[model samples]
Target: MARVPTDSPARRPFMTAVKVMLYAALLGLIGLAVAVSITYSQLPSYQTLTKTNDLGQTIRMRAANGQVLVSMGPSVGKWIPYDRIPQAMRSAMIAVEDKRFRSHIGVDPIGIARSAKVRLETGRFSQGGSTITQQLARNIFLTNSRTFGRKIKEAVVALALELKFSKNQILELYLNRVYFGGGAYGIDAASTRFFGHGAERLSLGEAAIIAGLVKAPSNYSPTADVEAARGRSSVVLQSMVNNGFVSADVAAGVSPAEVKIQKMTRQNNVRYFTDWALPQLDTLIDETSEPIDVWTTLDPTMQVAADQAIGRNTPGGAQGALVALDRDGAVRAMVGGRDYVDSIYNRSTQAQRQPGSAFKLFVYLAALESGMKPTDTLVDEPVTINGWSPRNSTRTNLGPVSLREAFARSINTISAKIGQQLGFSTIADMARRFGITGEISTYPSMVLGTSDVRLIDMTRAFASVSNRGVAVMPYGIRKVVSANGRVLYQHDAAEERVLVAPWVAAEMTDLLQSAVLTGTGRAAQIGRPVAGKTGTTSSNKDGWFIGFSSGITTGVWMGRDDARAIAGLQGGTAPARAFHDFMVKAVANRPVEQFETQVPMPDWQLEPGEEAWGAGDNAVEPVLDENGQPFDQDPYVYNPDATAPAPPDPNQQPPSQLPEVSVPPVRQQQPTDPSRRPAPAGSEPADDPSQSGADLAQ
Candidate 1:
């Protein structure tokens, strides 16, 4: 070939190429310098990888005595210091990820060139060529996008990290802050999550397996794919031997199969209570960044008893809920459902079901407030209003009964009459004032609990009666403190007067006691002078029994979500049995206390044809009308043997010609309805008719 002249066309192109190459190299060096300076200037000051009391951490709940109830957070594991990490894990990680980890400043130029060559030849970017320091930089400060600008920035940031921190510091940060999959955030968490032990106690095989996970944690997780994880660990061991971290003999001898993986066992029933209390945390805690210790008012003993009670009495396929509160309205225990695992819906505070007769307490409270004495008498005959005729569960009338007796029998007619006399609006308003925020019907049947209300609200309302008329807002958290023992929040119960008069509550309590002693709630009596009411909804859908002693107020409910009537279930039966069992255990250690003495009052105002009677010679005189006969005692009577008496139809009788009569002394009588008799053990009635007298609530 002819020699080309240095200044010829071909020679000029070659010289141009050489000059271009040199200029490009110079420009690259200048760009790298600028990038390094910028990345170094942007680096953060030294900060520990593990944050203690970081408000950003998960919330923690504890009992009143400082026992941990639950810790709610993304990172639930403890932080382990760098020195505590095992040497085997460190060697395994360094060998598998970057053999030149200690020797390289931050970016490994030789490895980068090799990775770049491989990518070009294979048409794939499988080789990352990332040193431990570069990975630490990307994990803490950079994003994982494969772009020229990001890579440049990553290189610069990695250099900055290497300059600012020692190799050991960089490695320490890498192992302590990297994600190990399965919500395990650090080496300690990863060790425990995979091996069921601490990082400091990891074996050689365990260390190799964990180190293998760094490349692709989800795919290499031993818990998820054992064979794949073992294969990756085998690769890691070979890499360790190649890097001189371990001898080939030692690497070959190590077996990933021998690594014992632990199954996570976190069976906690308190999650239900914690979930219920979560909303309160935002208002109760202003600083959630640092770990806060919430001190709640849960009585562990009462909680256990409540759990066991529901489990024992609740039949299969039937769901139940229970709530217990102290005299001051502190929620001692709450069972939202039969099993929280099956469902997280908290029935106690969230579910709104018809309270049935349980809501009658508010009605009687209204009646008591209206000067209706418990001893006042009313006819339990069927009454109709606007065409809604409420019937007694017995389908027959109790000729005459005392207000106290009527309540004990849960006579549907009497409650409907009382609700009519008071007016539905009056009863609805009174129920609202008592903390029942659920929608209440204004119909006459409202007295029979036609409105749906939450169990917590009912418990709160009854607790107000137990608290001597002072309204109570149910609270679980007693106090909140920081991890460093600084007081963050404290509960100071605000005083409230829900009832108009304290005496009204006392009188109502007396009436409730009478119900428990000889009325529908007789099955709920625990022999220590108890008071409460029984409620059953229409169609036997829901049953409830709420009662309270001098110190604790409890409410129990049993039903199915499908609104299917549980076979043979009644408010005064299964629910009452649960209440008795729970209360028996809850108050076993507490001293028995007497209720406040109820002050006596004069007779209540009478309705039409109603009168007060005295047993002694001090009886009042009889009042007579223009005619010489007693009212409701006139000679004209409806004989059952004949067809039902036809009223001189309103259209036939002249208003002025209606017969006038004289009233005579009325005598007290026992209820003729057999269902009015107190229910015996195992003979409880359904909330629907034919169950029992108290079953008429709905």
Candidate 2:
């Protein structure tokens, strides 16, 4: 309490220390102000915001008839500008992403205080303190890494952004540039990718679900994981209600179904086709910024019919695939699997499966092209090549049968004998000529279909057979036009005559007709003159039916994805039945015309080898010159001295009494109604015989 005299030496030391402290504090304030000014100056000006990359418009796809199939792009969709965003959606986004979005300038001090309090009380960091403007600043200009330095930069950038632009403009940039999961980058893309429409059309539930994805896109991607997405959406709905964006009753009543997210990209039904066609897009044109409108040959009615037919006939837990092509080789309908979301593997064009007896069309064609006629004799018995003995699926062998009978019954021994006689290389060549690009085994067992091939290729080959032996290349797209109406690509659709022999084609048609009528493919008859073949693989693992009308050719395959045997399933059963049902619906509106007169005797019948046996057997009788002598005889007549390998006759028995065993064969049976079969299971079946082809080799 002693009074210090003026200019005392002891008090002077303390006064000097105080003056130094004041000068240091003044210099510190000036430095901090300069730093803040410099940080704000480094930010991009609002005038340059409009010029920044505005790349968020969806790539749209339309079907052949102008039906909008899908809209997708690199982080783009219907560009719903800030002015057009629905009021409900806008409110929902604000409530879920940043509740204090309207009140805060750039960063929300109140939100930060609450978040800090929660973290301290809970001993966990759960809440984010960034405002909508702060998020927009980070998203557009800064990386999303979490660190103190980065947060400081984010806060500075957010303040700078707020000072440069209006609140509305900041909100607009955030909504238009924020990532929302899937391939969606903005609210517009999120709206379209999830709801299949513009953001303006978003319902309350949809807006909440999309808004919920901002925190973690992958964790809430509707397509990648629907349940997780729904749970996140419920949180958003509650937030919306809490923030007064929606009523509590409305939030509680929101059903997940009302917030539909596209289960698959683009449209639902045509994803298989679109996925298959997407790669072809880049091949058709160089890199393009604008979307290209593609016109495909997919017949909507036929596609529906094919889908329904397979769904009706395939057995439980067994998958099936179908591909249909018109005579001109345009793919009319293709169903790769039951649900594309469950699996995207395109069985129609990607999966390779053993065709079973369906492959015999090539073997029989090889026989015909190798100078063997339907009237020629083929011994259906055990056939051995290089110590590999191939037996009939029926276990019994028919003594002597015509090529036509062997083909109709899908006689494996006879087919093996013919393949050995002509060599499997010839059969493989024939298959390749008919558009089967996959590898074909040249082994004798290959005559019984020991190789794998895709359904599309098989359908194309069969279409060739139906198209008068003019081999066809299956194609889907008919035209591709740019958004500006420029023709980027158009299918020439010119028929490439790969195998151009009318006589052989006619003969094969006659034989296949026998297969449909009084043969293994009896179930495929559509109350009209139809022809097809039924094939059941070893252990009943695979079943296939491939056939064609003069106008359309189709192929169907059934089997479990795990290659498990379908009990009592046979090619002549479910697959043939599906073919019948599909054809019945496909040709309903079209006229049922008889198969072209390419064959002289469309319904000619012969008893194995003895000659004629049916009503129209002699319709095109040989012309007789004088004295009833025959003229116009075929040059490749059967000769006793020919070096061709003899047909197998291991057990000569009557055709009816032949042991009908299953070994991937065309076993004939009067198929029951298709209604008794199980519903289709998966998308497609692949080829890997449950029992190896060596089972026959033994």
Candidate 3:
């Protein structure tokens, strides 16, 4: 047996140390190789800004005279030169984002070690060792996946960024790419959004507040929580002083008073207009793929006036929409809703509700075209046809009234009768021709506005009437310009003659004047001549007022979002009041002009078998027979003849009768009780048959 000699304990220790050193060296080589491979493969060879989609990114709305109403961008980031950035702002950013920004080469080894130790000790991700360049890399080129793979890629990209771009370039890109609260994406926009000023005008405290938002914008938003934002900003200021970026004395002496928050004058002020014009612009630009500038007829003064008017007049639960157009159909002012930020439903162009008696203007126009004069007599009686009976809004009839009286009174029965007599199809055609782009029901009830119409459509229709029956397509943009200031496209006014006769339109306008003077539309009357109609639906579900003056045609609609009736609101109240308020302020500086008056009716008289006829035979003839019923005779056969021969004389027939006839004494028929007669044969008995029979017997 042979015994093997065991190695000494000292020798064993030396060998173990050598083996440990070898393993460490090998591991270091492997890590170095992996790092090199990742840096080479993951780093982008070339980086560029995301291609701008002008349609989705930027929009411009202009006035008729080529003035900008709004300039909007989805990315609210604006680039500024490094020199323009305040020294204090740069220092604050450095102190909060990266303390060793100037000395680091895109990667801070010490920061990484400290962050790793803290992460391991805390057992949560409490620290990020990303340099400014690394943050820029993640924002520009990498996704916000927050995974180990993404972090590794970010590190590689950060190293590449340092190698490719200068420190100032990296800082500029980072500043421009960060997000701030309130839809602001960069320092420039944040400055403008919060302070109502540009980044270059930022003070030390203001800069600190903006820079502090970079970490958690919503949590530290000045608009959302001033106290939390101030605390965060103070931390940034202290950090700047600690890092020697700002003097300790300056940091200590600064008070909250030194940080002036510029008042937000129009918080989400342009939101309504932007929401309305965006879809239209998208449709126009995206459809043709043609760059076009829409020169709107928007007058900022009028828009503000309209917004304020609607805000003031609409009830707490109610929202209102308004649209104003020029005689040429150019939109001068628009308020889509009460607050666009709260709700995006554009009531002016999107909501559809019954226009009520505001639709009577079309009915009256049809009647006028059918030889019915505005002064002609019309019975405002309860009318029943085919089981459909319409009653007056007042629940009582005004017997033997003139057409103008019926219209001014907004008698539902008269309007319904007129609509039925003219044919619902004819009225629908007229409405369509007048630029009403809604589904119109061809029912007898449609005469009293039993259909829904958008405010924009109504505004265009009224504008057509104001433009002497020349219908102009309503448009917002007039011209589009490229990013480099090149004219891309321009919009031309499209006009068409929609009414049968200009005179007919003029008479209709005159009739509408009575609406403002004494009818339901009285609330819309301004000092100048104004023509308008008021509308209140069956259950008061909708309130609408549409009118026009010399300078603008305005339409207002008031209602609740849930289709519920607003308390005490009618077309003549809130909507009309809002319209008047806006119009008065909007046209305050414009010269007053009188509405065109209708021509006088000519002298004419009712002949045999003809109902009561007025002098204005040339204007409009009564289409009624001697029995006060709708004329059933063909218009071609009975062309109105002022001079017709009388029948032969009865005396000439007396020579033919030779025999004298003995006449029996005629018995006088006993007068029957007036209330005992039965009602007309086919007539459906009213709800109270006895009362109906009595009235008919009378």
- Each model's lDDT comes to 0.76, 0.73, 0.70
Q: TM-score for each prediction? A: 0.60, 0.60, 0.55
- Report the lDDT tens digits of candidate 1 across residue range 522-591: 6786758688888887666788989898589999988888777677677888888899999998898888
> Stretches of candidate 3 above 4 Å error?
1-68, 74-269, 282-295, 599-698
Worst 10 residues of 1 by lDDT: 634-643
User: Across residues 38-87, which tens digit of lDDT does each residue of candidate 3 receive?
Assistant: 66575543334422232134556666566666665545646777787888
- List model 2 lDDT by residue over 1-698, tens digit each: 98887579988988899999999999976764565567678876655663425544345555656676666666666445678988877887898888887777788999889889989999987988889988887877777787888888788778777777787788777777788877777787787777788888888888878888888897888876878888888888888888888898988899866666675633455677777766677677676656667777777788888889888998989888888888888877888887677766678889888888788889999888776777667666666788887665445565777676677667777887888889889999988888888888887778777688888988887788788888777777777778788998888867466594776887788788767654677677676667777777778888888888648899999888887788867777888889988998887777765654234433332334443322354333443556776544331221223342222355965343222322111212223322211112211121223323564454
Shift in Å, residue 275, candidate 1: 2.0
Give RMSD (Å) of candidate 1 vs. truth. 14.9
Residue pairs in candidate 2 whose N, alpha carbon or C atoms collide under 3 angstroms: 337-683, 338-683, 353-687, 393-661, 394-659, 394-660, 394-661, 396-659, 537-664
Looking at model 2, residue 435 earns an lDDT score of 80
**Per-residue lDDT of 584 in model 2:** 88
What's the residue-level lDDT of 155 in candidate 3? 78
